[model samples]
Target: MSLKSVSAKIFAKIVVLRIQKWANNPIETQQKVFKQLISEAKNTVFGKDHDFENISSFENFAKQVPVRDYEELKPYVDRMVSGEKDILWPGKPLYFAKTSGTTSGAKFIPLTKESMPYHIEAARNAILCYINETGNAAFVDGKMIFLQGSPEMQEKNGIKTGRLSGIVAHYVPAYLQKNRLPSLETNCIEDWETKVDAIVEETKNQDMTVISGIPSWVQMYFEKLQKSTGHKVGDLFKNFNLFIYGGVNFEPYRAKFENLIGRKVDSIELFPASEGFFAFQDSQKEKGMLLLLNSGIFYEFIEATTFFDENPKRLTIGEVKTEVNYVMLISTNAGLWAYNLGDTVQFISTKPYRVIVSGRIKHFISAFGEHVIGKEVEEAMHKAISAFNFSITEFTVAPQITTSEGELPYHEWLVEFDNTPENLQKVAEYLDSEMQRQNSYYLDLIVGKVLQPLKIISLKKNSFQEFMKSQGKLGGQNKVPRLSNDRKIADALVKI
Candidate 1:
């Protein structure tokens, strides 16, 4: 083994020991984090506004601060963007992770100096944990490629601002810099399609042993490699054994990926976002990710079923139960207080707090982790049909993940038109264009060829009503969901 691989194995064991220390005392570790957050930010603007100085317990903190989404938290973020300091966190943030928002056009999520290291460490620890468990650190000696956005960041009021992935690209460890693939110039290419092509050219002949990216995007890269060299990804990089992914559930894309790579490889699932890096797959034998309780985040949970109810009970880690879906609330070191993360997760193991991301709190479809919400689709439909004289009665969308060989998956929109449009294909194009404009993730998937433009399926008149009637609710408050990640509703609509 190379000296680097030997060093990595030694380091991995040390990190795993630290992780086990906190994992064994999860609740106590969380309580410490909560107290520190309150104590440190008590003098800041948000803390002062929420009366954080007088708060002595979780109950008091909950009473003082209400759970807020991006729309509700925009006032403070806006000030931060305009160069205001100490508005949210102490002094100023190190960076702003700009992401597509539902109500707000773009969301600027703060990344503080105090909290930023955790993001890098959590990802590193995930790999280290695997290495420590499996005694496989040889990948450290070979090339690693992280398919990500442009590392070039723009300055917004003297603070660096860019995509979360782009921001992370700047922080890659110095030790691994030599082994990382796709030259800096290639990584800075703005167009994703061109970037992927450049990446394939740059890494195809290298000793690549670890590949990291969202599964859909990685599949695109794998397809390109296979087309160019007439070899599976595994054959192209003989030592490649680890696949690191995030954003969406891998099961949907697992078969496609295995087919492309020509074999199964070990994989790690991460729970990360602009808000924080909350969890990572810590074991090869586990079903869920290990939640980072000791990180600079305080957690709360409200049962997702009762989230719409008035004054829903916010439970702490000690109170959460296994197998129950709860909308996650977080008060992080980045200065978000009782922020609604919008993700629903089920605790598979409350003992050490391992969670599986269930779905978003809103009715939506995220088969590729595009997070296309109901409002965006409705607005897109309105824009798409603005030039036409016809209107659709009702519509619902579902992801069509299962496809024939060599065909990409797509969103299947079932629509009951008031009167059938003259050219249905033209309408589909307009609707797809509007969706791409509204959701950046959806746009990326389209441009990357990971998904085809959404396909519109026409439904006969009263199809929705007839389906609802069959379900014993013809009318009166019972409504069809606008979008689903699964195809149950779409199948029923097709059958009707």
Candidate 2:
């Protein structure tokens, strides 16, 4: 082995040791982490405003700092963006991670010097943990390609602003840079299509061992690579063995990805968002991601069913129960306090606190009292797809509220198919049935004749991509909302 490979293995082993120490007692680790975060931010404006000094317990902290969404926290973020120092953190943030917004045009999430290590370390530890668990460290010797957005960041009010991946790329350690693929110059290409082409040309003959990115974009790149070489990804990169994916659930695309790779490769799921690097799949034996308890972020959970209540019950790590879906609230080193990340998760294990990302609070359809969430839709789609032998490229669900007089409303699905099933109607029926099985409210609406059966709209190839492009959200961290209460996205898809 080369000297760099030997050093990489040693670093991975050290990270594994650290992960074991943290995993020894998750509860105690979280407690210590929370206290440290509070102490670090005690002198900041938000900290003094909330009297963080006197808060000794999680209860006191929760009571003193009311849970806040992006809207409630916008003023502080705005002040920071306007170049205010010590507004939310101890000092000005190094950069801002830009994310898609609902009401606002875009959200500028802060990334501080202190918090940067947590993001980088968590990702590094995830890979190390995988190596430790699977005894597969040889991949570290080869190139790892991160299929992400352009590394070119724009400056906003003297703060660098860009996609989280781009920001993270700026901090990749020098050692790993030697084994990273798709040269920095190619990574800075503004257009995703042009960038993918450049990446294919640069890495076609390289020793690529791991590929990481959102599944859809990675699939697109894989397809392009195959088209260019006239060979499957596995044939092109014989050493390729690991796929690290996040930003979306992989179940729907699992079959498609395996086909592209020409084999089933080991994969890892990550829960990194613009807000924080929250959780990662730490074990091959475990079904869910092990929550990063000691990361520089304090986590709180509120029952998803009561998330909109005037006073929702905030539960600490000690109070959280297994199998219950809760909206995640976070207070991080990067100046966010009791901020709602909008994600809902269910704890599959409580001893070490492994969680599955259930869905988003905003990504749900509740027309006529029949509330349906992203999880239900995704599960239903997976079942239907499997039964019908269909492969989907992309899909989104929206409630069709408008109808003629005496006509019942229904859910509309705009789907882009990679391989269409024999009968589209059967596929739609199976999906509706699976959804009804999962959600009792949806079933009741159908049984009571309150709503008609769901309708499927087969979108032309690249329809969703066209829609995303039209909205100026074609690449990077941008994702199509899977479930929307309104028909805005659906109508746009139809027009496309």
Task: Give the top-scoring candidate (TM-score).
Answer: 2
TM-score, per-candidate, Cα-based: 0.77, 0.96
Residue 158 deviation, candidate 1, in Å?
1.1
| Candidate 2: 10-residue stretch with minimal lDDT | 1-10
Tens-place lDDT digits, model 1, residues 104-196:
988899999999999999999999999999999999989999887777888999999988888898899999999998899998887665778
**Mind sharing the TM-score for model 1?**
0.77
User: Each model's C-alpha lDDT?
Assistant: 0.85, 0.88
State each candidate's clash count.
Answer: 0, 0
Error of 1 at 393 (Å): 30
Give the Cα error of residue 384 in candidate 1, in Å: 34
Query: lDDT tens digits, residues 1-496, model 2?
Result: 6665566677778887887787778778889988998898898899999998999999899889988888889999999999998988998999999887879768999999988898998888888888777767888789999988777888978899998899899888887899898898998988877888899999889889999998888888898999999999999899999999888888889878888889989999999987899999998898999899888888899998899889988988889999787999999989889999999999989867899988899889897888788888988988887788778889999888788899999999989988878788888889989989989999999999999999899999989778888988776777888889888899989988
State in Å the error of residue 396, model 1.
Answer: 10
What is candidate 2's CA lDDT for residue 91? 89
